[model samples]
Each structure stands twice: as C-alpha cells, then as structure tokens.
Target: MKHFPIFLAMEGQKLVLSGGGDAALAKLRLLMKTEARIEVFTADPAPVIVTWAGEDRLNLTARALQPGDVAGAVLFYAADEDAREDARTSAIARAEGALVNIVDNLADSQFITPAIVDRDPVTVAIGTEGAAPVLARAIKRDLEERLPVTLGALTRIGKRFRRAAEALPFGRKRRDFWADYYFTTGPRALAEDGPQGAEEALNTLLDTHLNAAPRAGHVALVGAGPGDPELLTLKARRALDEADVIIHDRLIAPEILELARREATLIDVGKEGFGPSTDQTRIAALMTRHARTGAQIVRLKSGDPAIYGRLDEELTALDAAGVGWSIIPGLTAASAAAASIGQSLTQRGRNSSLRILTGHDTKGFAEQDWAALARPGTAAAIYMAKRGARFLQGRLLMHGASPQTPVTIVENASRADQTVLQSCLATLAADLDRAEMSGPAILLYGLAPRAALAEIPQVPEAAHGP
Candidate 1:
C-alpha cells in the first residue's frame, strides 16, 4: 500500500487552496460541500471564483502565495501550472504540517484526492494509492451503478436509531432486534417511501421487540458450498436468508455462513465418523417443532441434500408431520472432487455411466449389489468408504471387476487440505491404509479413474499384499 488512505472529516475545519482556475474551482466546489472554512489565494481570480466570492459562497484573497497564509490549515491544495511554484507551495504546506495535494503531481504531494461518490453520510471514496486516478474514477462509476440511491436514506435511518439503540439495556439483544428489523422492515420501507419509511420501520421494530425474548426456531439443512459462494444455487441463498436457526456441519466454511442474516441463530451440529453424532430423528423433530410455530429452520449440510446427506429419513419424518419444507441442491463433493482434478466423471468414451454409493452398508458388504458396480465403462464414486475399502474392493473383484481397475480416493475434496490417492483396484485398501486419509473420502472406480490416473502421477505401491 503506497498510501494509507483515510477519510478526513474536514467539516468546520480550515482548508487552503492556492489557485482560482478551472482545476482549482473544481476542488473549491468539493470543499464547499463540507462544512469547511476555505481560504483561497490567487494572483488573479478566475471568473467562476469571482462569481462565487461575489455571492459570498467562498472566501478568497487575490494575492500570490505567502508562507504565513498556510498556517493552522488542516488541508492545502496547490494546482498552479508552474512546477517550481507547486513544489514551493507543497514544501511550505508540509513544513506547516498540513496534508497537501499537488494537482497532476502525485510524487511531489503528501496526499492525493480520491474519486468520490457522495450519497452523503454514505460517501464512497476510491483511490489507486496515487497510481491511477482515472482507473479509480472508472471503478467508482461502476460502483455507483450497483449502489442504490436509497442507501443514503437507509444510513440516515441508522443515525436516527443509534442513540435509542445504545440506551437499551441488553446490547446484543438490542442489536439483534434492529438487525432483523433493518433487513426485513427497514429495507422495504426505504424502497417504498425513502427515509421517512425507514424511520417508521425502525421505530416500529424498536417498539415491538423492546421487552421480547429471542424466538425459538428449528434447524435447516443448508448446503454451504462445494467450495465457492458464487456456485450457491438461488434456493440455497434464499434458505439461508430466511433461516431463523442454522445447524451447520463441520464441512461448511465460515465464509458460507456469513451469507446468513446476521441475527439468525447459528449452531454447530458438526460430527465426524462415529463421533458424537447428532441423532437424525432428533434433528428432524426439532425442525418439525420449530416450523409448527412459524420459525424458519435450516439444517445446513455440506453438499447436495440428496447425495449422502441422510435426507431420505429427514424428508420422511418432515412429510409424515405435514411440515412445509423444500430442498436446495448444491454442488456435490463428487462433482467438485472431479472438477478439482480436472477429470470429468461422465467422460464420453472413458465412462458412459456414473454410480454413487456408500462403502458402508449397515447390513455389511454381503447385502450390497457389488455386481452392479463391476460393469465395464461404469464409473462408481463411493462415499465414506475408508474403513470398508478392503471388503468393498474384495467384493468388487469377486463380482468380475478387473483386478487392475484404476481407483482414486479424494479426501476433503475441494478443501485446502485435499489430497488425492491414485491406486489400482488390487492395491486400493493398502494405499488408503498407508495414506491414513480419512473424513468423507470419495472413491472413484473404473474408466473415470483410468482417465484420472493417466493425468496424475502414480503413488508408490504399498508393501502389504493386495
């Protein structure tokens, strides 16, 4: 950072300008917007500056720059065309401890003016750290379009509420109430009736929730991401915004949770393999109960709700109770894992079919239709198969699967700690055991694995027998 950019509040402060031409007039106009007392020194005043002084809009002196004139000024601007004069003015201003801006000479100045968009009380300043003012202005233009004109009104409403809110007994509780109101009522009011509407909305919210306890709510199964928030489906974001309660798993990143309404209840219901599991039935019942009382429940899952998310049982219970519910599909870990390695699971010639199955079956591997997974050109992606890899591999081999079939196990797919282990079907178990990779691993078998193996370097074979 070339310059530590800051917003200087110049209201009711002294500002000194040393020119009266078009460039100087522009700076004068900006300074006038603030409550600053501006003193301008010009050898010859421009027509525009004369008109402003004549109307008492600006205070000016028609004289050359003097060393004593810059004293006690908070900010100074030197816009003269003469380089020597500009440098002299800058040196004097700096010696006097005033932040100075030398127009068109970034290197000679201690401060550079930023391109500003003032929707006042909500001013936005854009700077390129004195590198590119034109580029900064272009960016500011783009931002001006996305920022609503009503944001100024919204900010004013917040100003109105600050004192009242601070006076409330419970800081967190008061902040929570206003936050909820700001999103729900205040925005709507601002959109409908501008500042007046926002004021009314804030007042109503403060009055209504003054003595209230936080409401009870159920959990929602929200899919945080396959990795990126931009990849989040519209439905997923909507679920998060509406959720009164969020019970997210460990796989969901903090960045994803930031999308939720700031005041929404957040709970970590994260569980790892065979560790302190949250009862599915209990979760379902909690959601059902919360929904009955008009609370929005979100049970945030890691991936697409339909894929290995235990949705079948939750949906069954929700439906049986007649609770209104819906599912928002997310980028599943399988798709993300394949994407991370740049290997398409449904590659045309390498694999014509895709099968997703879990390695662990409650009834054991004997009950699983391992034969179906042995088909040629079929690619199977196994979920949570680290512990049962040996049994599962043996079953696939017995069911006519090729002993040399390519396999890839991806752990923590799409995450920073992601690791991919490539091995043949014969060595799948030993390779997995050697890597000691666990926690929701995805197993890719068959031709897709062949494609992936062909792309990535192979791992050394395990010493143990296949």
Candidate 2:
C-alpha cells in the first residue's frame, strides 16, 4: 500500500481549515460528523460558514490565516481551491507541526481524506491514494448499501458487553460467540423485537455456547484445481476458510494455500513421483490425530482427488479411525490441459471416447491395454507422463500404433507459465526433452494445439519401423 490508513480519535482535538468555498464546505460536511473543535479562517466567509459560526457549529475568523493559527491543531486542511493559497497555507501548517491536506493535491498533502460510510461506531473508509477518487466513492457506495444502518447500534451494544464476554475462553471460543451473536441470534432478535431483544439474545447465546463442548474436527479432501486459484470450487474455498489445519500436497499452488486461515496449521505432505515422498500411512495417521483434537482439517490436493489421487486409501483410513470426512471435487489437470490446447477431450466426430491414464504406478510405468489405446481415432490425456515418455512410446509402437499419431504436451496446465507443445508419436519423447518442461504436464493423444503447431523432430528409422 502506498498510503497506510489509520483512524485517529477526534474527541477534543483541534482541526483548522483555510477556506469558505466549495472545497472547504466538502471537508466541513464530513468533519462535522467528528467530535473535533473546528475553526475556519477566511476574510470573506461564505454565507454557509457564517451560518455555521452563528449556530456555534464552528469558530470562524473573518481574516486571512496568520502564523501560529494552526499551532494547537492536530490536523489542518488548506481547502482554498487555489493552488498558490493551498500551498502557502499547507507550508504554515507543516511549520506548526500539523498533518496537512491540500484539497485535490495529492503530492502537496501529508494526509488525504477518504470516502467514508458512516454508521456512528462503525465506519468504513475507502481510499485510493488520491489516484482514483471516483473508484473510492463507488466502493464507499457499495459498502453503504451492504452494511446495515443498525450495525452501529449493534456494535455499541457489543462494546458494552465486551467485559462480560471475557468470561468465555479467549481466541476461537470467544470469536464463535460473537460470530453467532452478530450473524444469527442478534440479527434475528433485532428483526423480531428490538435492541432490547437483541441484548437478551446475546446473553442467551453466551450462556448456551459457554456451557457446551467445542465442535468436532473434520477432514475435507479438497481439490486445489489445476494450478489456478480461480478454478477452485466454492466448497473447496469454504473448506480452506474454515479449516484450522491445512494438509496440502506438494503440487498445490501457493496462491491456493493463501486462501486458508492465517492461523491454520499448514503441513506439506508432498509426494513426488519417484522422488522424496511422504508415506500414506503417516498421512492418514496425521489426519486422524488432528481430527481427534477437534481441529477442522483440510486435506488439500492439486487436482480432482477421485482421479488417480489415491482418495480411496485416505477415505478408508479415516473410516477405520471413526472420523467423518467429505470431498470437494476440483477441475482435474486433464480438463485444464485440454482447455489450454482449445481441444475437447471428446469431440463429436473426432473421437467417441476419452481416456484418462497415469504415466506410472507403484511399480514404475503402469501397464494399460495398449492395443485398445493404439487403435484409430483413440484420444487420451496422459498424466505424470514426463519421465515415462520413452516407455509409453515403445509400448504403443509395439501394440501397432502409428508413428505419425498426433500428440500435444500441456505443461503447468491452467497456470500463467503453461506451455503447449505439439508433436507426433515418433517424436513425443524428443519433443518433451527439448522443451525442458518441469511442472506437472499432461500428454494429449489425437489432439493438437489450437494456435500454432510445434516443429516436428526427426525420428530414427529403427524406432519408426518397429
């Protein structure tokens, strides 16, 4: 943020202004809402300023501002609407050791007034560092409509009962009590009865929650989506929001992890294919342990947990431990990869069926029905195929697949760094190696990139004939 926002206590503080024009009037309207002792200096005071002084609203000096006029002031506004006068007035205020704001001059000002949504005790200030006043006003208008008029009154009531609420344990317990009061019980009571009813409801809520035990912990197997935070499902986002603990995979993006609560525990149980890994048994044990302690746990995965994510193993482990769990499906890598190339997994006339196959399993490269996959018009999205590219190529070729079959590799699918490379089966391995692709990629068979075609590499005569 270029400008840091802060709310200063205005009670008994002095605020000085140096104009009687529209610029001054605009500042005065908002200042009148505060409890500051305001004084305006203008030789020819506007009629509104004269009326305000007559009504004991503000002190008006019918003379030009002099040195020491802003001596005791905490804040000063040079709202003369004249650049020269505003600068001169601002200099004097700064010399007098006060924070000064020159109307419509961001560079000359030490402080800028924000568009405010006033609800007495509750105030929302929107500022854009003087770069966008219209945008700030739009936000202020939005907040004005969304926030209830009675929110200030409700907050005032809450302030009074803060000490009483301290009887409940600090942190989550106390937060839960307020969340229930403000969101549920208080609003309902205020609607049905009045402020008195709301107060009564608050007391009842505190009693009920304080006397009850804490909520049970849960595990939500949430798909983090194909490296894009936007693709995350609403349910998955909610799980991150409410989770006290986030147990995420290695492939999950940092942006996705950012959605989780700041106070939540983040455990990176990343399992890389044929690399440093975490045991599934230990992961399951970790889930059960945290769940037993009543912490809301989110087992975050990179893609759809149902698709080769070993979801059943984790589910079985949780079930055996008597722990409850749920799933929030995410946009798998295959879908994201296909979208990046502007091709459908199942095209009406091109291919009748789409296959999702992993490049490797527990015993290195996985075995599949290569004869069926090698047939004409076959389309498949191959995940984790980077290292096993040669093995896959050899197997398909042995099963009588054509060396000229189209293939595309989508690297870091759905992410900003995503790359789409097209090649034929004869050069699939060579193209992958030449690209130096690092992120999780999906190999597409019988599909090509929508935009540009990749330069096909020359295949050796031996591999082609075989």
Candidate 3:
C-alpha cells in the first residue's frame, strides 16, 4: 500500500498549512474540528481564514512560509494552489522533522487524507491510497446516510457503562450483552427516555446478563466447504465466531480458519492418508476434553465431515464423554468436482444411483463390491484414490468393467488451484501417475466432461470405443 491508514491522535498537537486560497480554506475547516493548534501561513489571506483566527479557532500568519515555520508540527500541509510553492513549503516542513503533505500531489506527499464518515467516537475512514478518491467519497456518503445520528450517543453511554458490564463475564457473554444493548435495549430506551433512560437500560441489561446461567459446552462438527471461504455456510461461520477452541483438519483452508475468533485457540488434528497423522482417538479425546470444560469447540473439517471423515468415531467418543454435539453440513468435494466438469453424480438413463467410496480404509486399499461396481450406469465418487488407483483399476477390469468407462480426476476441487484430468478405466492409474498431482483429489467414475461430449463422436477411438 502506498499509504497505510491509521488514526493519528490530533488533540493538542501542532499542525501547519501553507495556503490561503480555496485549498487553505478547505483544510482549515477540517483542522478546526480538531483540538490541534493550526497555523496557516499565506500572503493572500482568505476572508474565512481571517474570521476563523478572530474566533480563536486557529492562528494565522499573514506572510510567506519560512524555514522552521512548521517545526515540531505533527502534520504539515502545502496546499498553496501552486505546484512550485507547495514543493518548496513541503521540503521545508519535511526537513524540520514534520510529516508533509503536498495537496493534490500524491506522488510527492508523505501521506494522503482519506474520506471519513464521522459518528463522533465512531469514525470510519475509507482510503484507496490516492488511487480513486471519487470511490472513497462515494463509500463515505453511503456510510453517512446509513449510520444513525444517535449512534454516537449510544456508544458514549455504552462506553461509560463498560466496566459495570464486565461483571457479566468475558468472550461471548460480554459480546452478546453489547449486541443486545446496541441493537435492541439501548435504542428503544433512548427513543423513549433519552440519555438517562439509556444509562438505566444498560444497568438493567448488565444485571440480567450477570444473573444469567452460564451456557453449557458443545462440539460442532463444521464443514469448511471445499476450501472456499464464500462457500462456507452461515451456521458454520457462526460456530467459528462463538467457538472458544477450534480443532481443524489438515485439508481445512487457512481462509476458513481466519473466520474464527482471534482469541480462539486453534488445534490442528490433521490426518494424512498412508502418511504420518494425528491419532483419531486422540482427536476425539481433545474434543471431549475441551467440551467438558464448558468451552464451545468447533471440529472444523474440510468438505462435508460425514463423507469419509471418520465422523462416527468422533461422535462415539463425544457420546461416551456425555458432551453435547451438533453437525453443520457443508458442500462436499464430490459435488464441487462434478460442477467443475459440468456433470452430475446421478444422471437419468446413465446412472440410477450414486456411491461415495474411500480408496483406503483401516485395512488399507478399501475393498468395494467389484461385481456391482463393474456394471454399466454405475457412478461413484472415490476419495483418497490417488494411491489406490491401480488397485481399483485391476479390481474393476477383472470384474468385467469396460475399459472405456469414463473417469475423471479432479484435484483441489473448488479451489483456485483446481485441475481436472479426463481418462477411462483402462488408463485411470497411468493417467493419474502421469499427472503427478499432489493435492487432495476425487475420482468420478461413469462421468466425462460435459464439454467433451461434443467431441465424443470424433474421439470415439480414444474415449469410448471398447
């Protein structure tokens, strides 16, 4: 970023501006709002500048800017309406150890001002690093219209009662109390009885929150939805927001993890297929352990947790520990993979049913009913099949599966790095080996890319001829 936005404490600080025309007047109006000692140096003084000086809003020097004129100033502005003069004034202020701003000259300025939406203590600054001032101003206008004028008063009252509200407890409880006050109680009280009523309402709200019974612990099995933050369900996002501890899988996206509360503790319980991994029993134990301590825990899984995610084992542990749990279903990777290739899991006249299979199980190279799977019009989404491709190929081929049965491998489904490799049962293992794909993938049997359908007739010798 050319300019990093930050709130400078302007109260009782020194600020200098070397301009007297429209530029000077514009800056002075904003400077007057602050408690800073503003000194404007300009030979041709504008009428408003002189008037503001008379009102003791700022100090005016009716002369050209000289060396050391902006000494010790926190911020100095050179808006002289002339490029040559602004450059000269900026050089002087910068050498004097003050941050200089050449108005309308972003390339030379040390800082650029942002358009602000002011609600007193609640100020929102919109900046584009001097790239698009119009867009910034538009956003500011929208925010100003949406924000209620009484919001400042509500915040001020809430600020005064913050310490008293602390008796309600920290984390979600405190957040909930504030949310209630701002959205419901505080506004209603202020409308009915003004500031005094709001203060009284805060006290009543705090008392109710303080006397409320502490909430029980829970474990939510949340699916992160194919590595896309936008694909995450609202319920899953809420679970992350309220969770005191997050236990996520290896495939869970960092973008999804970023949704969790900053104070929430993160525990990685990722397991790899045919590689080093966290023990499943230990993962369950961690969940029950945290939940038993009255902490809200989220077992964040990539894709749908129920789909080959060993969810049953975790639930059994939770039940044995007598900990409450709920499931927030997510978009499974198979669905995303199908969408990427423009195909469906079950197609009329093509497949009557769908199967979700794991290529590897506890016993390794998980076995499926080879006879049933070899039949035509059978569709399956095979997970963890990269290493077991040859096993699956040999089994299906031996069981009379057609060599030309279309199969597609989708790697990193629904993610930015997603790739699709189209092949048939005969070449499934060889094609996958040639691809050398490292990311998690899903293999779709009895499906071909919809785009490739048009070329099917022309490529029959390669894709479909048996």
Best by TM-score: 3
Clashes of each: 8, 0, 0
Clashing pairs in 1: 219-298, 220-297, 220-298, 220-299, 221-298, 221-299, 222-299, 222-300
Write the residue-wise lDDT of candidate 2 on 383-447 in tens digits.
99999999999999888787888899988899988988888888999988999998888899877
Give lDDT per model, in order.
0.77, 0.89, 0.89
Taking all chains together, the TM-score of candidate 2 against the true structure is: 0.87
Model 1 ranges with Cα > 4 A deviation? 1-10, 14-32, 38-116, 121-139, 147-220, 241-245, 261-265, 274-297, 312-324, 341-344, 347-353, 361-367, 386-391, 410-423, 427-441, 447-466
Scored by lDDT, model 1 comes in at 0.77
Residue lDDT tens for model 1, 297-363: 8888888878878888888888888876667778888887777666788877656778888876545
TM-score for all predictions? 0.66, 0.87, 0.88
Per-residue CA lDDT of model 3 for 1-466, tens digit only, reads 7678889999989999999999888777776777899999999999988998999998999999999898889999999989999989999999999998888998998988788887877889899998898999899999999999999999999998888887867787898799899989999999999999998998788888888887778999998988879899999999999899999999998878898889999999888888889998899889988887789999999999898888899999999989999999999999999999999899888788899999998898998998889877789999999999999999999887888788999999988999999999989999999999999999999888999866543333233222
- Pick the winner on lDDT between candidates 1 and 3: 3
Could you tell me the TM-score of candidate 3? 0.88
